[model samples]
Target: MSKLEAGIVDGASAGYGAVACTEATKNPVAVANALLEQGPHVMLVGRFADEANKNFGFEVVTNDHFTTPYRKAYWDQTAAALGQRDSGSEMGTVGAIVLDEHGNLAAGASTGGPTGKVDGRIGDTAVLGAGLSADSKLAVLCSGAGDQIFKHLVAANVAKYHVTGSSIRDAARKALQSISATGASCAMAVIDAEGNAAIESTAKLFSVSWAPASGPSTTGLLPTSFPILPTHTIHQCLRNRITVDRALWGGALCSCHGRRRCLSILPLHGLSKEWHPVTSKEKEFHEEYPGYISSNDGPMMAAEKLDGISSRIRAVSGLTAPFNNRFNGPDEDSKLFARIIRGELGQWRIWEDDHHVAFLTPFANTPGFTVLVPRKHLPSDIFAIKGEEFSALMESAHSVGNLLRQALGTSRCGMIFEGFEIDHAHVKLIPIHRHSEATGTTVTVAPFNHHYQGSVTSLNGPLLKGTASLTLDAAELRKKIPVKTITSPRSWADPPRHLSAVLQEPWYKSLFTIQDALFHDSIAFFQKQLGYKYRAAVIQAVAGTTAHLKSLLELHRSSGGKFPRVTVDDALKLVVMNSNDWRYVVESDTSKGRTLTRDGELKLIQHFGGAVWVTEMDHLSVPFYQAFIDDTQAKARCGDLLLGNGEVLGAGERHVEVKDMLAALEQHQVPAQGYPWYTEIREHKPLLTTGWGMGIERFVAWVFQHNDIRNMTIIPRMKGISFAP
Candidate 1:
């Protein structure tokens, strides 16, 4: 590519002797080398120089070239300052796709590439046809787990769906379903020929903003924020050269064309087929070709078999007679609704009480399939539930059903209480998006009848979408409270020589600084400006990013002038026992927020720890962003880094108390204010301000692919070992 650039430059300088299309197309590489004279070899200095300028506010770094021969101090110095930003020297980095009005469609992805990706590895972002695609009929860009997105070519398929008559919203949703089905979170932006636009994500991290075509040009608007101009989109600014240069560049159009401006989750098609397992009778009759399973089995036999399977399968998670020895005995069966108070199972619990616990079941026949189980070990018979008990259960069921619809982007919910499954009295609440789905589970726990089908994704089910952390009623899965008596001994020791030498390379050592800057920059984008801000600023988001970064860097230098690295297995050991611990969950502290849900948590992890985009709500308007770490590598790496060695430096409790006390001190401010001074001052007046401290280190690790976040931190601080304080 660099050679091509140099050739273009040399040609411009040489003369205007243009080659015909046939000659250029047949021998492009030959033409660049020339017919005889020694060909000019071109070496590229890589894009880090320009990337540094764009991200770190550096100067003299953008679009600059220098004589390269390992001797040019000026160029060498510039290049030295920039290393592999994130995702190493690999196959695919990151990309931003946006339509430009420079009369051409230029796709630019502003978000950073997945941090610790493999060398020679590329994801959808690197593939134009996969992550981004455009034509005369439509254009689309997608974000999420790139591998899944690439396989489905979400961007291209979205365009196809749009041109084939699907509405803009429908097209985007349908395209995303392919990736979401794989339990991978993804977001997409789409625009059709009519200029109608839509954006959707299976997960909640999607942000769509646009300025009117004739309105403010997207000149300086932050990419993560709103797009000020139709053309100056964040993606356009960071457009991928390969994508642009490889395919012909052409003029681009606006998604929300014309002078209108709008940014919202577009209404989806009001239709979803009620998916269900094959009826027991049908399954038995057709189990094997025409003969089926035990061809002569009586109709009653099918029901009996299905019921037995449900009873066993539903109880498969934590039965007393467990295999791995995790469970002392079998827990309650699915149908036995009364045994729902199994908090130890670590399932996604929404609401629970002494009589009943409402939770999203892993046995989800449909997305967001929830069940209300009674605490008592009662029989599956509804008659077993006394009037008062029934009333109470029904009341909660009604409420949960309603919340599921409201919070999950569905209009109706189907309630079922079939005795065929586990003899337990459990009530199922399935969000009903279409008339057919009203039947709830048509088949009796068939395997194929699963939630998050690798089909088009939708929140039409209680398939809780956004609000990765926000639940219906500040509800969280009630975890088995940790043993208060347990004591952790913090200890520390120097790492192996190889690990200690990890950051010796200058470029490698800079990983910490670069990612820290990225995080701080994100903070600035959220804080209340001298002008507008959010409606509600979270009280705990008081940690200033600048201060935090400075302190963290100081610690990193002190530790080893770099972060440490650890094997995945070794990293997991730090928190394996506490994997179920709430602190590990990617979310704001549960005590602070009202709406808390773990649907996203379970969805992402249940399948090797990948996330299905939060399919439902817009959490920003409610609580702050609730991060859900679904990837295994990202999750385990975080545990190791967070522990430092055997434990974190500050006690979580004291830290919270200090923050709260600080907030209290605000009242003392001369006629002072509370923690979020903006709320008191009405900074972003009228807008509900929401705030939360994003785990910058975790994000950095994720993007930078830091093996041991310790690589970026100070010396290992263990619980038992004292540091050189």
Candidate 2:
């Protein structure tokens, strides 16, 4: 998790390019190279340079050439010259996206709000729901006052508009307008795979005006307060955040007790099912199966005779017991035991004791149905069960499960069993649904039940249909109390390292890679589309092309050092200028008036034309922009980069052209490690778009939306020691 100080930046202000196709693609080196290839009129934004490098460890996307201060200075001077003066207290924001050689696009953003600021002052750059948007092929983001952005639900709206056939610009305008109408001061942009773009702002002449030092300020016009924009919405932002969090964190099952609790016992009878066992009277005369012999003293033995008539159940079904264990004595609750065993007075489906064994009648609701030895505490394990016991257990379980569907009208039945808890073995008769009812499970008992601490509570049961006696069916009893998923200390030490086999598959890798790429691309594109233009000049003295270089030098001299000197510097400027492609804008803490933009430099230059076009002619020493461009385009194509425009560009001549242009722009750009991970197999890919946004404080500050990871887990378990309960 990257931890950058918080603040805000507004797109409604002058610095950003505002809107363009693949606008957020900021690969600095690539962007600079691309700019050299294009005419000088093009500008780029080296957005999020400081924060990205410090926090994310590496650039996911966007150029990393310019610092926040540099970008802010450029915007500040531009605003000043245009008659808009700077207020020192506003936050700095930069949003960027970069495309890798394989066409994967990465997006990210950063911001610093009003200097002496209040906490929780979120800006467009920091808040994902409004700040950034990414998916395979394109990326989009915004920069402006968060309050205003939220009014429009900008990020989500932009995405929606893009999907509905609007160009990046169109969607941005629509989103911005929606919020503007709501009185939110905002600016927005969008970019797509095919180079289509859109940008729109609700207000002009917007400038950062500090809020009162001690109290709040009322909403005002742009340059002061970005009252509202089209795309920001509280509900939408929340929903999107929740969805992201859920995806980031998989099932919350805890390994504390080392058991999965797919189905938890809820205190609701309607949510449970009960079963019964077959009886002698229920079986036909010819369907007899050998039974266990119970002597007058209660000693039990298996019958040796294989009567042609078949045991009580053998004729009708090839069922047998799954396990057998002999105990000399029974618990003091023999009356309760007898009732359960005889299937006469107990409500449970299966029960056993020294005196007898009986199973309650089966029901339509029960599946994988079978009566098994429920309470035989012994050292022997399942391995001891063989031949008839195994066959009977399996056959009965299968038959019962099938019959249950016939009885309950469900398609399948779920079977589960665990010999770890009770001294005895028991088979679970569960009815499976089209979808498993068990969201997850946790095992709380462990290490000889050492963690055991008892909780006493009164039980709840149903009144008999016509009688006053309370009848607690096992299923009902299970539901009457909340069953905790226990975690065993031993299971917590170290889960089996993620199975390498499962991770090695293409599907698994694709899930992460494509998602990441899509996210970066989407965000970068959005920011670029939303940024404003600037006059970028390269202060270079190319050997052979001194005349051409002289012209750039002249332009720079005229701009009063506003232009960059080195190719790298030029690249950085372009990105800073175009950073908003996939970034957001929000107000600084000093006041609601400030909004920010952020992203990569190289990607910026590619999206927005820069001063020079990298010719196959430029010196090799000069970083090539076309290569970066090509890579970015490839990333987009492979869904590694977001398509801000929300439309797919299939491969062919047009795509080829875009690819070439990108390659040219990317030439000479520095490549980073792990860049190839974003690549994917072209033939088999899921129809998905992905991007990542995180809560810096949540991860860094150790405070989560749900308080902590522990709160979100089934059962908290740490290393080595086994906890038993």
Candidate 3:
């Protein structure tokens, strides 16, 4: 497994810095893709930093594109706009994207903390396994403080917890609680491909701001309980278009978390459903792509501009990141200056007003999908542009939107302007299926929860599967039907029979008989073994059955009036109050058929070795339960020998200590390969783990030649998947 690699970005003043890790490879681009693709698999801690470039705004580019000075300048400029002074030399953000080329997991991270931060201070972003950790199976991220992260070992601990099967949210909660114990504020997000995730924060003041891979946005201190996605009533505006920015999704913009700044934009429902898994075709061609920036949105500031005057560079280049805001003014001469360099002064029928420019990429083949960029480098926003610029921006957006509808075969289109918020104005025109088309002909109804039995009858007719043959279980059919309940044992013993019974009664199916019979026997066996064991035993009469009569009489003694003061009812009520101890009694006196079903066999083995009355027997073991009764005839012949003497027995058989014959058998040995071979290897493979075992009831029922296990009990069972008979 590859280890984690990390880096730090010191803040403007030095206090706020971001830490990052690129896993398993040195390729920063691969690292970037992996981070976006599989994160927040890596733990993030202490104000994790993420940045997008204005140059690569609408286009999809590899991480290699980020290495250019222009891109770096863009990053620096955006940071400066966020209240940091730019050295105009290099970028401070730290990151790398790499694939698993060497078969080892690797990661790296770096960051410059909060802007205008105090000098010499560091956040959790730079530390390995603090903000990020990478192994073959786990990756994590922390988005809070290094101090809090360290206090709880949030990254590593959350990563480890995730490996153990805790859900991501659960692990996040634990991580947060761990930090909270030390009175530290923490927020984190973890994604483990292992189906575990945890998003949490220690700041009671903390709020969860998350954009789900699917479903709606969430913000606030999430409840530890409930599915990761919460259900709520939604409106149209919040369902059409949205920003890709995670912070914007749930952070300051969420009214749910009491963040009053939640912007009410159209929900990106179409994008959430369709634009996912951006295919090569989708990326290469824009077809009503609702998420990407569109024409009329302004151009991005590629990089931070320097004051140095390079005549040659200035000849071919436009203003850079630090260009004066006046670049967007109605200055025609200034607009013409840019137009002259591009060699398209009115020749290509260009429209310029020192504010915006429109251009179609050489590769752009789709109709109505053009890029709009402002002459000045600034964050793009639908609400920010003014005067002619605003009107021009809208006109451009409308033109493109109409073109998209005509070309993409859609009625209306979605407009999304998400990127370059820190610096540069941009917008996207995305066409989508009309609301009616998307909704389909039928409305979707939620599943019925109350009084729902997972049967077709519980649902509306339209939702039901079949039409010709109404299921007898359907609500309408059942309402007109009469249900017969057997209150007395006699009624159950001799159920009323009729010819129409096959169609009207539920018991017409032979499958029901087999199921009910087996279940009934199993339930009895469970109660006999696990319930008041001293109270009863299932009576069976057999000619060769040793102690058969004696065992019956012994059980009858307990059933008689001279029973112990504290009865089985008391024992059952004390342990399992819901238990019906009376049901454990098996009165098979005149019975011709007695047998145990598969469920009986299973229940016998499970309950016999695990009862309050039997649990204390250390020697008792389940493995032996099958072996002892596996050969009941042999066991019966050497009863006392199997019973005990000086030889101690396993837990379940502890009450029966061996003395003579059994003690002698303890040391006997015979050929290992012989058919009837026998041996007493207690000392070598000591009977330290022995027990009173075997589904004796099942064994008897099986050997007794009964067709069903229910014959062995009083009232047979009628529910559950598997039954005794």
Candidate 4:
């Protein structure tokens, strides 16, 4: 027998084989088996082995069948480059070990001698212990650098270590280490009588698969760590179809039912999915925000609401899992405001102070959109600030605006205050670029058409149809109005002028008598139509005043007169100067004051010539959170930025002191019991905070010079409108 068939054996028989010459025999293993069965010798080789194969009736064939195209190319290239062919060019040796039901073990290895080798050269594959070894206790098969393997007796060493009480893994490692020390590479698979097995290699094993008798089968490259050996007997099978528990290992059978079914046993890192190493850039990001994992495995911090478009900001901890925005309560543990105050949710934070934080909104309505939220869960009303809090809030607003302008290369920023949706006070900032490509060179200053002719007949037509004029003196009407006792001349409030001082002017007296007479008649008209009471008279007065001013400015512009020429700004100043008389009657037992209904307000807005700022409304006319103009608690310390579409932004100071809050609560008729936490903040740790909110859609509409606010929202959420996914 040749060395290729030197040490191979079966459960009840022994065999070995090798290709002896260029045109040798087929079935090398069969020839080796014939030699073992027919002779007293343990092996045979060269011409003698071929003659024995023919004499024993084994089939022989031409050498071309064993010479693959790849081996032939390697032989040619090696001969051309090194002046001689190399034996290493021929690879893909075959080997196998089998255990039968009787507990007998056997192994075999076979390969043609390396291409271009010496005519009589014999390799390790035909040796007893170098390329193949088998006995009752263990079996081993090795491939690679046959001469070196023969010199080191690699397979024999593995069997030696295994028989000497070393584990299959330890024996494999020892054998591999010995081969590596000799400057050679080799790989081997060893199995012991107990069914334990291991494969150790100095080169990649390429592929490995296993199926235990009781679990799913798996296939993949071996992990860098320990191999996960099968717990039950496994036999090599054809066609790569590993069987587990008597069923085919495919589809559902391959899933990890109760145990890990992966080919390699790797660390899982407490995640449901496979662990992946973090990239270098992600590591840097983690270094910048320490304690925050870049992966999706940590405390639940933020989530998208069911609406899909809107998202909820959440606390890093203290919240229940699977957060839902629709189910969240105002004072719930998940409130983002609470965590911001505690400094736990610091990721993505841009700017912050003792009372508030400014961050880039994850659900930005536009580029550079940001949210400035108070750290405390104060009531959703912007008017609830008082004292220095008012000034600080304004300062914060200014700072945010400047930041957006400088960072976003925008000329201005838009602000708004409407907290009807979220019961948290958050101010929205939208960067306003003057030269937006969407609107081009056309800038929309106001959203209404200014086409009314500046004629008394045109302006008076609507006013005359609504009511009959009153004959009361303007001076008498002015005395009946309540004069605020505590007042300060601020930029947002009228310059500390008494109501009487305003009524003393000739122009104010004329406008006051006409506006008052028209307001009463309009009230009568609205009461008769709706059969209910509302402040529709105030709506009519504001609307009429707006029309009248626009007409006067239009007429002046058309006249082309130099002396006493009237401009739109001059007309607006006239309206602001006469604001002292912008009042409506409040009947006894009704609310302290009233403003126009939403629909009525919208109607009045259509008449405005341009943007206008109104301030110092009646204290009871607004929410109790608005700070009082003074200790008298008569007027709210708030201002509204009204556009042709209605109030787009609102700024206000909040009540910081307990007494002031209690007094304002009583004046506005809101019960203190309903706001226990809000009351406690004022009682224990009052903060002087002020801020403003702006509607993102309205701001974008204003910036882009669009008349329709709906166009501004990419996914518009209008009242009474439903959208399908």
Candidate 5:
């Protein structure tokens, strides 16, 4: 074994980034055993830093409890790290090679074999030169089937390619292509003596481009003198013309080969004979793309423009960490307009003026979703982009809107300002397939809220309970609504199911399981989750719950239902909840944000009608009830973990009232010392959960913030002042 890890910490910023380790007891074996336990034999054990909070904790590497029947616990690994497929390709190694500042070269790997193989199973992990190798000249690390890798000495082959003067990226790519031609899946990450690095994976390809102040601009996937590129930052204009050397898609068009969709490349900066990763004015931004997932919409790409730039919403749909007003900090890096005007992240640049530029946005309900922004001025958002600059942008938007009918084969395109993700003042061109789909911010309700059941009415009208939650038992609930699994198109930006209903079209497919889960396994699951005495015996049965939760949440968020994401702590709890708890309602608003506090949970409750709860446990542990409580709609309840000794732990205040647990709780006050997870409504009674809800239209309306989307609800209005216009 390559030295057991002293500790695994994701020190990405500190330069001691995530270290991927593979495992190997010995050689390869094709003695395929029965499906005894072929679960994803992947374990992610590490201390990940919470960057926003500046805290660190050992993230529970959701122990992949099982490999068969596709358990839910398997999802946290995908959410946190590069998600691995669980089926036939379960035999992959985790390895890396390094070339340091002083020219030190070192390589290491750990391997996991196919389901049930012999101990002497030699493959890449056991043999250094197969999965990885490093010498004075170069270092190479790889991940893939060990059998194919060992036989070809894939690592040594890449080194030989490097010795023969092939660029490190090309050398790795060449070796990978050669072996992959034989149909054994493989990918490579490489580094040469000068400390330059490159990576190739079956999942997707990402280009990390940087322009150092003194030396030539560098991109791992690109050559200094333009090379035949497969995937580059897409910057092509909307004119549909395809060429092998340089073609663009997803800014405007897309093509699929087999199951893989090669979503790559932007029109080489300005179509010059030589391709530059960045333009002259982009010297200010330091860029980093730490890999991305390939998807139907496009490669779910991620780009980090650092040194003080406004962070952007990563390509992960519904993930809006980058959508902030962290712009214009009087620093060169903060100048996003300077980079945008210089063609810095542009794709499908159809038209431009002295003051504005129009480009394609990835988040689209229709194919040709585009955006119009000011080029000459740097305004924070729509309110700031005023006077001549705003007028110029509006005029450009009008011109672009006029062309949408012909370009997208739609009757018309509507423009709306959505500042949820991008703080920059830009207008989105929604290609309205239906004339009346666009309805602006209007709140509609289901007319049944316990809070609003009998409330004081304003001069405008009575407070309408647009949505409500009835605490019904499983029997009672099943009688009312049809319960089935719905599979949405794999894009988070696709119109949500509710919105599709608003349009009277079912674009998504609903998957229905003819039966429910096996109750014995389910019983053991809740036992393990609640930490009963027999919990230890149900390890295998309960271990895979996380993957199920991860998948469910991903599907929900991707399908346009509000699924608030969290670290493995609450997420794993949710995995258990999916199996054990009969039905769970993710306490989220129509928009986004979940808080689990009596203190901070007031926002969602006040906005509509809800309640908050906290079941404080040890900060180091995940309590069963805390799972239900932490499922709230606030970013952070911001509490503290404390001991009876009265030492303040993480984030809270302990009153004399908290000493009397039942008394305080009966009055429905609270309890706490930790902040791992929390939620609102009914007390955390064992085996029972009461919840709240609102109209789906109101929630999705919040998600797709647009005014033109009018809904002709079978029933339009009721109590209170419902949106009419």
Candidate 6:
């Protein structure tokens, strides 16, 4: 026999029994018999019990096999109704009491333990005297609530009564009475040395039978008072079906399957007849506004119109309440924009007009952080506005930047126009402090200083007379500006790092490298000529291009040995680099050779040293609101302020003509239906104007010399993914 079986039997024998059983095993009766033959020991549990059973040659079954249909049904009903399994019930056990002619008496109990009992539970059935007891005078077996039976030592007490000279019947009855006093119920049968037997129970007992040596066996009354496991609840049955379906498919069951099955089973008590994830009106609202509310319309108001939209409304509202709800309505007192317009938000207001307002952000990461918001309700995407309103919006943003610089005691500021959290179009202005504060954390900033060049020269005019001098001798340029080599080895596929490849990386890294290299050269050249830092040195020039300048530069290396021979007119039309895709390269002559690359022997050159302003951008590269420079439609009246690391600000004059707006819209492929109001405003009350915005984080990072923009925001939201607070 296994050590565990031997131990159980030995322990039972030591406690006045010759046999024992455990419901934890597949064949409890067989295990009991094996233990009885194996000899004494106490308990075995968990993995140790399993090992013992294996060694004793007892069949082992999976835990699931022990869950009878009745037990599972009962568990389902109880858990569905009560949200927890019943723990007080006593069931799923059996035992036997025997008397041999040799005057030997034995009692044993076997059980699968309590139904729904947690793993590793050792019940009274395994606790020798608690469930079974035997002596020369009598043998007793008891079954019921394991905890109460174990506490009362029911079997042993009955045996003790018999050994002390009480009749078996009287002893069993008294033991039961003792258990009843404790508010516990149990059933028991007792056998004396004379072969007489008595059965007694405070609770209903299972079937009872007896047979005489010289007579046929007869079955006695079976208890009918015990409650049968209740039928499984509808919710329980539905859950069971879903579980089975998921197991069969090895994936999520279709939501429709659940709904259909549920509907067939019972009525959906709280759901409406017309249920939809998103109703027709909600879809229309989304199509029109995309990311902003229209007028006084909102999700709550929309939900009231739909039969089953409340639940979805609650779900979405719960997730976005902290951010989106703050800008729900123009007159909402809780809205930051509304409070700011009312002069109730922020430390101070910076600027305001009939159509816009600006103020310092209370949760500023930097000393002079400000937010510029439109006075009128507007969508988060500025492109949703049309004609002069777009231009006016840009102008307002530009004014905010200027105001922030003056207010914060700095000549430079960074602005960012992004609708990250709210639905309204807001621009953030971050002042570019000249020097880092002593108490502030370390940050990265652009090393190159800006010397503002005079007014932007018209690119449509002839090239400057000294334009040829701008292309310095490669060998001479190298002597003035030392170029860093790509020391890392490269394969055929991975060529030496070029300006084009460098431009593909994050703007901060690549742009800084280019700016630093050019700045060093410019500083050296000007210092040699002036014998000091030429703070006022500024060079401005205009070059036109017939083809897209950006595309021309990208294809320079592949365009054979010759630079694309451009006519004077081609050079005049500047190809605006929209987004972060544009690359600027200069052909330079070094000690090794002449090459067109960012880090090649010939260094890159900027028309203006400090902040270069370039206008007349390619029409296709800019937004629809940007007005065409002329009827030719080749260039738009848009420009960028190349300051700090790179272009820190962008401004564009908006198109006032409805026809031009339509054409621009077609070029950009924006759905026209969604912009009906914007189109109406453009056609009716158009105003010719311009606007610009700057990135606050980028500007602050540039001023503080911080490489990462993420460090600039207190609760940074990255690519729409938020982290736990």
Give the TM-score of each candidate. Answer: 0.24, 0.22, 0.22, 0.32, 0.25, 0.29
RMSD of each: 29.4, 28.2, 26.4, 43.1, 28.7, 39.5
TM for candidate 4 is 0.32
Question: On residues 262-372, what C-alpha lDDT tens digit does candidate 4 reach at each position?
Answer: 121112122223322221111111111121111111222233321121222122212233222131224454656555444446434445555666665554434445577
lDDT of 1 at 546: 26
lDDT of 5 by residue, 1-725 (tens): 12111111111111111112213211111101000012121121222111201122222222232233443344345334544433223454544455455776665554444433333344565454677666777777766666777777888788876776677776776566545434355667777778788766542223334443466966453211121222221112222222232212221123222222232321111233332222121111101111111111222223232101111211211223222222223336444444554644544455555556665544333445566766544443465565876677778788777666555445655555533234456776655454343432222222322331211111112221111111122224334433232222323233333434433432121111101121234653433222111222121121211222334333443445443223322522542233332211233422322223322222322222221122342222321222222333122222332111111123332212222223333323345433223322123322332232233333222222212113313223445534332
Candidate No. with top TM-score: 4
Q: 449-487, model 3: which lDDT tens digit per residue?
A: 333121111011123222123222233433443433212
lDDT by residue (tens digit), candidate 6, 64-91:
7656678677678876776765565546
Task: Give lDDT tens digits, candidate 2, residues 1-725.
Answer: 11232212222221121111111333322332233233242332323433332332334443332337666566567566756533222444455543334444334454443332233344455444466655555556566565556444577677776776666666666566545534434555455555454444543323222233365754322221222221221111211211111000011212212334322221212211332221111221111111110001111212232222123333234334441234334544343333344334523233233322324223212212333442333222344566655555556556555654554445655544433323344444444443444332221212212121211001112211111111223224334434232121222234352234224533223233333443455653443443211111111110111133234334443455344223322433443454453222122222211111223423432343223221111112222221222433322221111111111121111123333433434442535232332222212332233232343222211111122333222233446533333
Q: Which regions of candidate 3 fall more than 4 Å away from where they truly are?
A: 1-93, 96-103, 126-128, 141-153, 166-408, 411-725
lDDT against the true structure, each candidate: 0.38, 0.34, 0.36, 0.50, 0.37, 0.48
Query: How many pairs collide in each candidate, listed in order?
Result: 77, 220, 111, 23, 58, 30
TM-score of structure candidate 2: 0.22
Off by over 4 Å in 2: 1-369, 372-399, 407-414, 431-566, 569-725
Provide the global lDDT of candidate 2 against the true structure.
0.34
* Candidate topping lDDT: 4
The model with the greater TM-score, 2 or 4, is 4
Worst 10 residues of 3 by lDDT: 637-646
Cα lDDT over the full model 1: 0.38
Candidate 1, residues 676-723, lDDT tens digits: the string is 553333343333222333445445443333335544443444466543
